[model samples]
Target: MGSLWSQFSTPNPMFTEDDVAPQDSKVFRITGGYSGIGFELAKMLYRKKGRVYIAGRSDQKGQQGIKDIQHSASAEAFKPKEAKLHVLWNNVGVCQPPVGSASKQVIELQLATNCLGPFLFIRYQLLDHAH
Candidate 1:
């Protein structure tokens, strides 16, 4: 078996502004973006003038985060065109048994939320709106 440290491997290096060209009104979607690293990442993209759409199953929390970012942007005098909601963050996560329980019956809950939801969101929402 692999060492336990492998489970906690460091993430890939962060990209600098110089490394990545600034997007022109690209839709940025993040799931589970209401809190934690996803929220912080959305904020960073917003500050960099990207349209950020943070998505969460909880509407209250998701809207709150959006308002907080908008408030911060207004305080910083960033124009709406410069920073707006474009991408939808699919940050939601869940865990279930490999096979669903006889009563609970949630075979695809985790996959649908973590995988298919984001895929469909990108394909449907972003693609439909893309120029």
Candidate 2:
């Protein structure tokens, strides 16, 4: 196992405006982006004029988060032209399993959620949109 102490003490990687720069024409889909780190990243990208899609398991939560993010993003004298939507539904669904005391079902769910579902979405929907 890695040193837990070292993990906590390690400095965050430094960045400048150049490093955090965004492209106006890129599409962003941030999984779990309705809160925490994902929210912050979405705000930054959206503020730079990138279209952001928030992906998560809960429809109610995701819509709420998207509104909050876009509202916050548009605060700097620029208004958003449209509410972002229409790309969140997927052919497959992923489940977030509880940590510790894992069951076979939970294990399978986490694997699908954390891995397989994203792969399928990217391979199908995203690629189709890219071209």
Candidate 3:
């Protein structure tokens, strides 16, 4: 099927940072954005003038990520309560773990990280911020 072929095909990104228009007053939140792909995405969005917030378990790492984005984009921090979220990226996830592994709450680690955490984040946090 076309969808299946596309999955295995060489990645040809149809949209890049160049295509992103100036974001101005837009607000975005990304989980697990302190590192890896999420970090890069946060950087891109921030460069376009969007207010980017990175959320994770580690406050230290999150603060560092915010600093990194601000330094890279030469932008100032925006207050959370004043900004309505234009986008929320549930980018945090975990892969296979030890068979008996569980989250701090005793739920299965993968399920908690990939599903439950995002759900609660949206239900509790995103709702209040959504436009």
lDDT of 2 by residue, 45-121 (tens): 77877777776768998888878876876633323443333334332333554555343555466666656768866
CA deviation > 4 Å runs, candidate 2: 1-13, 16-19, 75-107, 128-131
lDDT by residue (1-131, candidate 3, tens digit) is 88888888867889989999999888888999999899999999889888888888899998898888888887666674644678889899988988989999999999999999999988887775564
Per-residue CA lDDT of model 1 for 1-131, tens digit only, reads: 35576668855557753466555466576877768888887776777666676766689998888877776653233344423455555666666735753223443667666677678777876666665
Q: Please provide the root mean square deviation of candidate 1 (C-alpha atoms, Å).
A: 5.9
Residue 42 of candidate 3: its Cα lDDT? 94
lDDT of all predictions, in order shown? Answer: 0.65, 0.63, 0.86
Which of the two candidates, 2 or 3, achieves a greater lDDT against the reference? 3
TM-scores for the candidates: 0.53, 0.57, 0.80
